[model samples]
Target: MEILKVKHLRKTYHTKKHEILAVEDFSFNLKQGEFVAIVGPSGCGKSTILSILCGLDKPSSGTIEINNNLKFGYMLQGDNLFEWRTIYKNCLIGLELENKLTKENLDYVNHLLDTYGLKDFKKAYPNNLSGGMRQRVSLIRTLATKPDILFLDEPFSALDYQTRLAVSDDVYKIIKKEKKSAIMVTHDLSEAISMADRVIVMSPRPSTIKNIYEIKLTGKSTPIQNRKAKEFADYYDKIWKDIDYHV
Candidate 1:
């Protein structure tokens, strides 16, 4: 099932003296329960695409069809959790805003917290948790809304290398376990290769899809493990060369 479809997507920023096109003729369809990663160079309008999809910004010309009857949840580069809110409260923020904070929803959030090793820290403040834990809380908050699609924009870039790998695995597992679909914009080729079912490489601004690689592998492995898979280096080399071609 196709959850979302984009046709001839374009984003043009109009300014006093110039109009800059960020993305042009970007079109794709995302299937249900699929994880798709988009990679591009800096200033290639990665965030612009996400913003337009989320209705935070309007595209110059395009059509986005969301076939699902669920809201879209966005996770930015930072954790985006309110520092003053406790972990549990942070998770409830979405529910509160949507006026859907019922006991059932709160219980579901609690279940996620407990299942994810955050049970004991529910009452703790965000400042008390590690970077990864904070990110988990942020994801829980996004999931609390029960979105049909998740938009993640480099949510792990702020973490250290070791922490990023661990958190990437955790997040990948959590999303799969929950059976949620996601579209992520990332510059990390390894991260994109490890997390996405398909990785779409884009050209510089105005960004356009240059190539899309379907990652094929055997067995479930950690991102680090996936990186070391026999076929992993082949993908890395191929994607590297592809992106380099655009550069």
Candidate 2:
């Protein structure tokens, strides 16, 4: 079943000097439990599409239809964890805001932390945790809200090379295990191919769908493992050519 649909979406920014058209005539549909990645050049309005989808920004013109029963969780580039709040408290913040801090929900949160190997660091401060651990906490916090769809905006951009790889695998597993649908906006072609079931390629300024690639690899594997799949290089080269043509 389709969980989200965006049609003829457009966004233009009007400044005193000139008008900047970011995205134009963009449309796509996301199926339940599918992981989709949007990739484009730096100024191609990839992030703009994400913001509009999550209701952070309104499109200048278009239609966005979301399943009435679905809830959204957005994870920004940074973990954005509160320095003052303990790891446990940070995870609880979302539930608290949504008025879902009931015993059942708390138990669910605990289960996520335990399943993800963060149970031992619940009382630790954000600074005390490593970059990868902090990102896991951020994912846990997002999951705490029980969202049917997740929006990840360069989620692992802030992490170092090694940590990013590890965290990407960690995040991929968590989302799959939880059986949630996700739309991720990322610039890294390899990362996109590794984590997404399908990659939506966009054009340059005033972006639109250039092409969509269905990533099919044999066997079930984590994102990191996907990188080592036999088809990985082919997908990478194809996606690179698409983005390179736009550039």
Candidate 3:
């Protein structure tokens, strides 16, 4: 089932002297359990479109149709976990701020921690965990509110290359295990090809969809394992050329 639809999306930045067009005519549909990754030139407004979809920013001209039953959760680049707060408390912060920290919601958060290998570290601070572990906790925190779809913007960019690979695998497993859909904006072609069902490639500054590839691997598993798929490099090369051509 289609869960979200965006059409004719465009954003413009107005300066005192002139106007700058960032994105134009971006359109796509997100399925109920699909994972979509978007890649483009650095300043092509890839993140801008994500911001509009997740309600952090408004599109100057567009239509976003979200299923009434779906809710959104956004995870930014780094872990951003609070150092002073315990891991459990960090997860509950969202529910607390929204005044939805009921017994049921609290129990749900606890269940996520226990299910995702963070049971022993509930009381531990963010600084006490490895970079990969912290990213896992950050994901649980995002899941705490029970969002139906996640909007990720360069989610693993802050981690070291090794940690980034491990964290991507961790995050992919978590999202699949929870049966959630996601739309992510990432610059890494390999990451996008390995983790997404469809990869959207956009043009420069006045961003628009150049192409969309449906990633199909011989045998799909975790993100790391998916990297070894027979068809992986082919998809990567095509996507790389598409974006490279635009650049």
State the C-alpha lDDT per candidate: 0.89, 0.93, 0.92
> lDDT per residue, candidate 3, 1-247, as tens digits?
9999999999999999989899988999999999999998899999899999999999999899999968899998888899999999999888988899899999999999998898999999998999888988889989999999999999998899999998898899889889999999998999999999999999998889999999989888888999999999899888888888542
Error of 2 at 238 (Å): 1.1
lDDT of 2 by residue, 179-213 (tens): 99999999889899999999999988889998999
User: Which ten-residue region of model 3 has the weakest summed lDDT?
Assistant: 238-247
Question: Using lDDT as the measure, which candidate wins?
Answer: 2
| Candidate scoring better on TM-score of 1 and 2 | 2
Off by over 4 Å in 1: 245-247
Locate the minimum summed-lDDT window of 10 residues in model 1. Answer: 217-226
Models, CA RMSD each = 1.5, 1.3, 1.3
